[model samples]
Target: MNKAITEGLLLMPPAFSNGLDQWSSQDGTVGSDTYDGAVNAAFVAADQDFGGCLELLKSETTQKLRAMVQTPLHPGCYLQIKARVKAISGNLPNVEIAGWAGGAGDVHVLDVVEAGPSVALTSYGEVVEVSAIVGTGARNGVDMPWGQDALYGHFGLNLTGANGGVVRIDDIQITDVTNVFLRDMMDWVDVRDYGAIGDGVTDNAAAFNAADAAANGRQVLVPEGVYALASNVTFESPVRFQGQVTAPKEVRLSLTKNFDFGSYVDAFGGDEVLALEKAIQALFNFTDHESLDLQGRRIELTRPIDVQDVVNNISTYAIRRVIRNGQFNVLADPAWDTDVVTSTASYSASTSTELTNVANIANIQPGSLVEGNGVGREVYVKSVNVGAQTLTLSQPLFGAASNQSYTFSRFKYALDFSGFSGLDKFVLDDIEFQCNGISSGILLAPEGLIFHVRDCFITKPKDRGITSHGRGCQGMLVDRCQFISNEQPMRAQDRTTIAMNVNANDTKMRDNRVMLFAAFGVWAGTGHLFSGNHWFHGDGETDGVRRAGVIFTTPNPKSTVVGNYIDNNFIEMTNEHDATPDWNNQYSFGGITITGNIFTVNDVAPWFSWIVVKPYGSGHYLHGFNLSGNVFRALNGNIERIERVDETYAGLDMSKSRNVVVQGNAFNSVDTPIFNPLMVRHTEAANATTWEIPTDGKLPFGGRARRVEGFVMDQQVLRGSNTAHYEFPYVSLQQGADQSEAHLKWSQACRGRVQITLRMDNAT
Candidate 1:
């Protein structure tokens, strides 16, 4: 392109009126006739239609003229090169308008001998127009006879015949007609302008970026083909996608025009699951958006969506990320089925963490729950050794002995975050998980900080609601959520799935509701605040069966269970982590505060207590246990007591447990006339010689009476004890400290109703 003429800013070669400046003939040393590859070349006058013309006298037929246009041809543009030519004298020769492709610095790349149809000059002094359409590429009706590179295109003329005559050529023209075939001229740039191939084999990274940079502020068009981008691509301008692109998962993409999932839905033609997967993958890898908004679309998945994978570039992300406003429904796919392994395993009391098995250990998942006869609750297989045929457990078994059949159940979650180890400040807000009775709600990361789940509904999960496999629940806040399990209509005793599982510490559960599960929440963590919750799993049956509403891994947990509506459920405290407290410090074991909670039973069992201490070993006792400000009511039968050690274990050692406060609780027709500090009243028989009464198994927490203080005065003493006006009764404590019974001997068996205070001793 020599000079511009404004036809799409078409650049033109110089006219012969300028005396052939920038035009040259091929030197004659090789294939041409003379030193200038011509016998003679002179600028001269021509017909009036042409201002002037160049006359070249070809001594030999191989002589030719060449003119190099330094400007590069636009990609996908076809240029028509034409010239008027006629033979002056001698035999007529055919002249062809040929062009050579150049790369850089006018360097010759490849030449095409026949750019267009060759025209033979038949008559002397007769004007004939010869034309050819040469294109930068072979697309858009331009065949391979004319193909131009990105840098330069040199237009030339060739004459053939042994006795070629003098020829005068004039009115040379080069016109850009790219838009005539590819598209109309517009304010946008096509990626093909920068040598982008749509064949799906060539990497389009460099070409795409060049087009984007050339667009400046204009829109970029990715025209139809499959383009492979081997590296990450960033676009600061708007882009229109008419083709698909493929890249590795580690390659991040920034489409500034449209970054929402709706746009992807449009891109993939309404395939929502694939759109969601792509959107989430973009969310984690790129810096464009910190949160992924599902826009209230219900995406159904046939398999679990693993959050952490090799596709993501970042492993430890402390930035706050949010995924909100979407409902995930599970479909019936066998991929949702969790792995389960059943095998015969033998456990030894001496080796609590190792289980010897003779089965397919390769099928056992490392994090599967280990359940068998004598298997402790909340025990999981930490690791599996296929060579040794042994399973390492997260916690030791309780009383595992001999060869027992064990079941290792691996849990599959709808949204699995168990792959990330250092993910923090991630929030899951306003999401509904419809598990469809096949999968669990969410599986948390193994190690993270402050994973918040709020305003969520986990409904009808087959296994668990929100489970923490490791220290992922550290500082986790679950607020304004509901966890209802698939055991909704099952009896409390028959239900097996738990609503929630907390494996880490410092979890704050606030304003949550739970319904119909074997256990409302079984947690091992400390510093938990369970407030404003209503947990019930009764199923309204008359069997009087109940489930544990609040269960702790350690009996002396430092937590507060307050303002909860507990119906037909009991609280169980245990030490499933270790059989004894020797492995832990005293500070790790703490007291419990169960106050301001409502405990009620509809058709209660005759042996149900509001709270029970279940320790695996005898060394741990209740410390700072407070059962106050709670109301226990029964509809059909009376509850035995407010609190008791598990009936399967021995009686509570009152001398070892201390700081017991069980008061301010109102019992309705149950635990009638309950008084704190272990008290009983009796009216002596008329004219009795001696009196002895047994107060065994009637006191709460298995209190053993230390001493009997007062004999209540009757009839006129203003119902006072230890302010008696009549003779005082002599009382003595019996069955001391080991059994919960008191023996009293009144003074000479007086015929008066006496009330004595049986002061129970407490351990320091």
Candidate 2:
């Protein structure tokens, strides 16, 4: 047996000494090899109590130290990362030994060595295998760029929020030594320095050009400072360009121009023609070097001649030709406010007028009244100058706060990244993006790619915030994240996770918090898992009511939604103007296993309450769902009538979906017990091909279509495995008329350790 020892640390196996030569004592700041490995000078008492018995007091200068190990790693190698951590202070933070793969940019965070309440100073440290970062088995595999100056990278010891504590490590080795070669390796490139050109002073266009030029499948590190952008920046590669480090008080990143239309759509005649031609060329068939006739193809115009006509013609793409009206002479003639009459009371005609000497107070005016072709209604305008408008104005006129705190004007997306590809693993960590007042702040489409987002906060999403669609991407994990939206928190397009056109499998959404949105929070696609999330959708007078704390949609076959807490939602919608009418739409699934969750819906929005398990798109193949061991408290919705089921389509909608199992679930303070908990599918009304539910009809008997088959209905089904103390005495048949095959059996008196045996056999 070999024993290796350092100054204040001891370990078995001499291999630790070689691996730890790169680390020096904590006398001074650790060199670049160790980022900041200085033992806290303030930790005088703590360090002295290492092997001593002085009853060490927790020091005030608690700074966790991090170091990098100098080891050579190659392909096909298996490494066991072991760390012996002892927390001698109050609630010591978990000590982690992380492996940083150079090529693939992978950081495998190993098991946590924590000093729990049970973890004492004696027998405090133990060696455990966190995980294996195995290299590829291919012969021409990659070798970790070790020993080389540039190719080599450093692993960081993130003392995240670990104030004034000490942790020790030993037996850290890369074992199972099969070498993964360089050929089969995934190369990782991180933009270490995002060269900022303009300091919001000189010129920012160079910074954008340099960033766009250097934005590859790496990180574009933007130093914490003001980068004044004169023009729109286009990032055609997978890169992250960070702004200020300490989060700018006003706007960390400010584009010189208020709005850049050329950034999103090419208004230039040449580039637009080229893009159009490329698209048209793909559709046409050329044969024998002879060009086909591409004439007589006409494009329709859509923008209405005026503002009132805006909603009328949508399919049309005609741009509104604005002729500026005369400027208001506020100093000479204050004739606009009291007697607001002009060439045309319509804002449409006002756009055509030019205002030379008049100050464009369009920015500061509270609201404007414009005339429509028919009768003029009070249409509020949020923007003064068409280009630049305060982000606070994005809020609805009725919901505007009394004391407005101005931040920044609503700017276009900082970077238009639709053209960039191979960026599935794009990382935007440790940064802040303020819409300052923008819309849909950071729109991302990892679009059929694998990505990792950690330690990031995307706030002030004006509209449907942070919309992402992973059509066929897998292993997308969003960890330690936050999103604050005024509207819907997150919206995912159809078939985002499952194998629609691509396979979106094994997606993990964990450790996230969302606050106060208009609609659903964290809405994901089919065949995904949601765990360990704290969501709060506040129901106040200002915010419009939304759907669920976390809603999963579009018919997922097999998925698990567990360990989530949703409080104060759905039932809080009021009957007032634009209020979220229903609140308790919680934990509804067609073919899912919902376990270990809590939902609380009290007063405020009552008309819509209760967890609904309704089907989508005519309720087809909604089978094999399990609801077990969850708690629902303070739920109050209409006991008699569940809200509109087939409101989108005319059909005999299914009240209960097929093959659902509800077992070992408890409900408290619940007025309207679950009626048709499993909403089934039925035939649509004639002449209805889409989800257009008819309003006039009696809405069919028992709410919607249902199936009373080999399963438990109204009451909770008991599956004999769980250990929770639950009793279902009177199982009532909610909507079934005759003695159907599926019937509820009520036990006369269920006692203390009584469990129900519900076996769902598919016997026709």
Candidate 3:
């Protein structure tokens, strides 16, 4: 079940129904400005209690009004401060909600500001909410003033520079948003509070386990230290573990256990018993019934017996068998043959590719490629008319078809469920989980909900860093994290054993940094948003690692991937062998939006392009893609920015791929930009529609012989000397229309003396 963790209200007598007994106010005057406030009737009647509200008035000067409420606060928790304010006249006042912490000779203050003019305040006033995390790094000062200690603080609202205006404050509130699981459970049982040493050498796993069991559902605090675990630590119930509030509470949980998880084995009968035996022998090197335990009975096999003998023996004994960690391989069974139907009637060569059959046509599905032996052709099935006993192909047959035999093959995969399972409503924050040479860092099995992993560092895993598989694994958010040196930073694989089955959905990956990810950085399912994340491949070694930034493997309906604000992200090629950077499946069915991303290609390798769209099945189209406002910087000038690959090739059928907009992209290259052949194919056209070739050895009337559709190069600024002869259209068109090619032709005397600047404005 899904759970919404509510915040705890921290304001005492929040409404200000009484007087300002619980609040302290300070007024400062500068440049003939006066501040005035009391329980007044300036606020709206509905918001005021007892027909009165706290009002602060300023008159024609720089006046400051500070109203603060001192309260005990926990560090590292997010505090949401809200209030209702009005600007009676003149400029709107600047509002600041700040947290002040003082202990061990240090005073730290963090502020969240809602500047005056931006806050919409009129006679009716408006409610504004400002959120800030309370921690040492969030301190407002310029530098660290004193030594660090346990944080204790108060929250306050400061209204400053209200020139010639009266701003009233009412209905103020502060909330504790640290532990979403149990916000009201303030009675925390710390591991150190319950006889636990946080030294690096001591085993604190038992102490943490004890404190978790005894604290019920309260918060369990693990202070800033290195807590080592000699074995795996398991939590049986819901618990909240909070760390120090100062920095990212440096609680390192060192685990030293070999990973092991349960695996599922299917029931075998008939000829399947031999398949299972072969699979077991291949996976675990096991042979013969002497080493096997079936149905709690030890059966001796004297000779090479058929699978029917084992099935009869188990049926006679009235026993059931359970296999653990046993592999199961399923090949094509001769009993379930692929040759289901044959053509009953035949006809001569016709205009259409429809064939009549006497057998049931319900088995024929769309997208299935069927081959006709008589016609010597293979066509993709478009539709099957079950009532008419006819099947239509996407293309016409080459020749006439007689009675031809047809067969269909379906792909299958082995069942591999070797991962952890059964974790729910757990939050892993403010901790560093290092998997030293292990395959998986954390793998959630079939179903879980509301799993939040934020503000953590995961590094050095052999395989995936974090993965959530299975159905009902909804609302899993991985935010503000760092993953370093892993095979796949994060992935969401299929829940079942099928090859193309997808179950993970509604997962969000935001504001994470991945460095040196060997394979795909993120492989997510449908309805997943990947935003504000940065990925970098290996430092400088070009040893051919399959480095894709983000890949959407599952068939999602609609998704969005937005990048970081700056230009620090480097989307390297998919290793040195295949230089394609990223891949998106067209079968996702969902419209994908890729915007505001920056691709940095610094290496001097043969880079294919930024992204390639590969469809799952034949005739599948990539629809409704909006790729705009991205920057491509190629320092080595060997990269094709964007190439559309349909059916495993670098070509796109514009009729099938509909509603694609590629605009507002900037490309910076040290040398001539390498445009993909698919993008500049029109430049090689033999005929010109609007312009004529020149007779005299000069340039053509409109420069090139072809016009490129859906791409516009608006302006070209050429520099240097030596009379460079550039042949291109010196004209302008609509923003997103076809563009003419700019061909630079100069003698060897002007080789390195000229520079060209071309601007790509629109693409469709």
Candidate 4:
């Protein structure tokens, strides 16, 4: 797919002979270069042989071969230049590539190590396709910084760098390479004379207004230059602020005010970059598009501050690399008031004295009226209120029939996004957001709109870093974003992290790197597709930082979590209830299509208790669940741990959960595949008695204690083992599994009550 659109000057001369004697002298020049009928003379040194030099001074000779082509190559067209080098002497010499356009500062070079030895006279030709420089200062994907004159072109085999080897170069040719195959994929427009609004001269405000005039229809180009700013600017165009240098180097975009990083100190002392501060606010709010793209521009914050927190200001991670001045610091504000209210239910003393509690229930909403039909089946406000931190669901009550258990099954919701119509697209490519607090990073109201965040880096967001509950927010895609945590700076309190916390349908999160934070890396809602994401834990919390690869509560119809890597998360972390629900539910939140994912851990096994397949409610049908093609590599054993307190563990729990298939996985070092045990906890309420039965009486007796005198009771038998029963199938290996073991394990878990299926393949 090589398309040649334009023709530029081509100047590469040809050479004859075999060794150094023919190329050492400047007087000996060859005239055989061609480019679209244009040709140039290739000069050579004399007294050098065509093929004999051995043990020659290579470094000194190469330093003299630096030659500059007088004419510049056109950037609008793709060009391929070929130079022929022959092994006229000893061995082959190394090659270096570099390009420069107009300005002295705008120059780029790519060093590639080619694999080739000496070539005899019979084998004397090889063509290499060098990759062109991208972004700014590049024309048609190639580096053409020499401008129209192209006088600064320099090319030659640096024989000086070679230790003692020598080679003769002949017949050098340069031409416009054609890419006719990909005419559709590439579009080339003549932008050589395009006008720029603000060449660092006009008002910054006016520049932004003109740039974003078309919203998502235009891509404003930022040429190489220094753009001084009196005020901040914003860009809403589909523009790319390509830079010639890294941040704070050649170009600078100075700010006027100070940015607050909460506890995280600022790089500049007390002083803040006012322009950047406004930009930070805009990025988080996703509103006010004033001054975001600072291409190749250095930004000087008014003051220097320290940055310790990494979870609150996820943008700080990108800003960190931009710091080039005095005492670069970080500043962040804390989120002391961010939480959610869950659902709860109660029962009458006589109707249902034995009541159980379930954390993080889904099928219920807030402030709703419910109906009932009989004595033991009534629907009240099925929720417990917890302060300002509350989450309101769409529905609360379930079936209120007397003949059967009431269960609220599937609850579907779509997040809304209002107030954001002027904005069309939100593209965050190659950007970084690092949080610096103990709270969430991004908290959207019930109506946040369309978003496309790609190639962005986010780190350590205090609570749930990014969560969405808004409306009109369709086509939400997060791809190639890096999510990590930093515990060194802000040690006061750890903000449990969830890279992407969204409750939306038709959502897609793909190819993201989620490192260890506080808790679950990705806690999603329903109707979402999570594919090819990498999740890992660096720290060894009895449970590693990530609690779940993808956590969702409600029943989702078409949600799929495929081709993800979830390993080493929630490792070594104890499952003892620090709170009611331990943090070991790394993959607790479920109701998803878990397929083709790799789960590896050393200790804290994957949670398969009430959390794994917990039901929606009493009579609701929870189906369409599939757990296939997932690989689990364990260093220690125990891949699954399930502890159920009640025999009737709801319609949502795995007992009643259907259509869950676990096959085509890999497991190592893990002793058992699954473990489930019944646990009984003491009542936390007041004194109550319903049924009293004599344990020692031989016959029917009431309120009478009978003692067995001849029986011997062992202390070990009375006090059961602390661990649960280890049963069920183990994870499958990728290479292939034994048919017998696979069948045996498969039958044990899903014989009849549930249909368990198995296939031996190397798909993981």
Give me candidate 1's TM-score against the actual structure: 0.79
Off by over 4 Å in 2: 1-416, 445-448, 469-474, 487-505, 520-525, 541-546, 570-589, 613-616, 619-621, 635-647, 650-658, 672-764
**lDDT scores in order:** 0.69, 0.33, 0.40, 0.34
Worst 10 residues of 3 by lDDT: 258-267
- Candidate 2 lDDT over 293-386, as tens digits, reads 2122221111101111212212221221111111101121122122232221111112322111222343433222222222111122222443
- Please, what are the lDDT tens digits per residue for candidate 4 over residues 1-764? 11122433544422332333333222122332222111112324442432321122243443233223322343333334444444434444554332222223434323321111222233323322222221112233344322222323333333334444444444333444434212324332212212122244533343333434523343444444433334434444433333211122112222212122320112222223443443343334333332245442333322221111111233211121121112212243321332232333342322331113423444333212222322111112223234322223322222222222223221111111111222233444554444443333333323333456667655554444444433223457778877766542331125344455444457777898876654343332347777898766534444333333444433443677789877554211111111122122233322456678776665453442212333323333223445566666655445443222222324322222233334444445443332111011112121112111112111110101111112111111111223222334332211112111111122221211112222211111
Q: Report how far off residue 708 is in candidate 2 (Å).
A: 10
Give a tens-digit lDDT track for model 1, residues 1-764.
34555345445776766655456565211232222333377777856545577887777656565563443465545667778888888778887776656665645555533355667888988888877766544344553233334355556667777564777888577776667755555767777666666777778787777777877788887777877778877766677778766656565556555666665554344667666666666677663677777788888878888777633666677878888998999999998888988888877767767888648788887557788866656676655689999987666666665788888898888887766756788899999999989898887776789999999999988888887666677889999998878877777889888877776678888888888888887787687888888888787777468867888876566889898898878888876665342323353223888889888887766677778777665545456777779888877767666666773643344555566666788888575334445556666545444555556555556666655555454443222232433554455565645555555444443455556666454544
**Deviation from native of the Cα of residue 300 in model 1, angstroms:** 2.2
lDDT order of candidates, top first: 1, 3, 4, 2
* Tens-digit lDDT string for candidate 3 (1-764): 11123344344323444434434443211122222244322333453432445565554243333334334433233344555566555567666554344444444433322222224344435545433333222223212111123244444455555555566666555554444422445676555433345456656556666656756765565655545555434433333333311111122121111111110011111223332333222222111211222222221211221222222212111121123322222222332222334344343345345667635467664434355543321233445678987775434443334555565321111221212123345455554544433323444334446556677666554344554334324667778877766333332121111111123567777898766554334343457676887765533423222234455544333667788532222321111111121233324222677788877655534444555554433334444666678777755345443442434422223333344555666767622232211243112122222221111111111111122243333333232343432544332321122223334332221222212222222223
TM-score of each: 0.79, 0.34, 0.34, 0.37
The candidate that wins on lDDT is: 1
Can you give the lDDT of residue 751 in candidate 2?
17
Q: Model 3 Cα displacement at 751 (Å)?
A: 31
